[model samples]
Target chain A: MKARIKVTLKPGVLDPQGKAIQNALGALGFDGVNDVRQGKYIEVDVAGMSEEQARTEVERMCRDLLANTVIENYTYELAP
Target chain B: MKARIKVTLKPGVLDPQGKAIQNALGALGFDGVNDVRQGKYIEVDVAGMSEEQARTEVERMCRDLLANTVIENYTYELAP
Candidate 1:
């Protein structure tokens, strides 16, 4: 089993890093790069578990340490 | 159109940030947290563009700023 976790800043949040990337993209000649937001991804191997167990484990991971709820939110894809 | 980009450090790579999180989770009573990896997430509005165009745009963004290919890899989900 494997899982892919995505963590992102919620909407309406300020993303200075993203803004910097947006500007850099425009300077690099990649036109129509209308917007850019920065985020993180985590991939893990869930060797033993059902979908329910995996989800519960992942949710705990997110809330406890994987994410800073004050500034980030997360979602994950788990494949058995 | 909109997209979600997830960035993560490749496996076999040390993740100090993740280790820190894992420790925190354990301290907080989140048992069974075998591991934790930290990453970033970005969600953006793609107002207009086909999937191909958006992908090209995103790849450039990842290369230029969103991700440091030397140590990170990224994947994205786009919904039109």
Candidate 2:
């Protein structure tokens, strides 16, 4: 199974990297961009695990390592 | 409009960050993990643009600033 995860900063958290990108876009002449937020997208391949097991495992991974729970949020999807 | 973009390394690219994550997961006792790849997820808010225009503008932003075309590929979705 494959799991795709997205970890993003929670609302009201400061995102300096996202702000840099937005400013760069403005310098590049792209207008009307009100905001930008950047996050991590992770794809994991698991062997010998059912969908339910993979979901549980991946969720733990997110909580333990992939995200800082105090400042970020994570979501994921699994596929065969 | 809102644009959600995923920028990922192309196939055959070496992802050291992903390898590190996989190793960390293994050390953390999460077994059966075959592989892991990491990417970027970006959300952009565009003001006063229709779907078609937003799509075009976002594509340009991806090509010009968000993605390194030599080794990265990007995909995006737009929502009102």
**What are the per-model C-alpha RMSD values against the true structure?**
2.9, 0.5
Query: TM-scores, in order shown?
Result: 0.75, 0.99
For model 2 the local lDDT of residue A20 reads 100
Query: What is each predicted model's overall lDDT from 0 to 1?
Result: 0.74, 0.96
Give the number of the best model, judged by TM-score: 2
How many Å off is the CA of B8 in candidate 2? 0.4
Model 1 chain A worst lDDT window (10 residues): A39-48
Write one digit per residue (lDDT tens) for candidate 2, span B1-80: 99999999999999999999999999999999999999999999999988999999999999999999999999999989
Candidate 1 residue B80 Cα shift, in angstroms, is 1.0
Q: Clash number for model 2?
A: 0
The sequence of per-residue lDDT tens digits that candidate 1 reaches over residues B5-49 is 777888888999878766776787755556667777776666567
- DockQ for every model, please: 0.46, 0.94
In candidate 1 the C-alpha lDDT for residue A9 amounts to: 84
> What are the per-residue Cα lDDT tens digits for candidate 1 across A7-69?
778878998988877677678776665667777667655545778987887788778767788
Best by lDDT: 2
Candidate of highest DockQ: 2
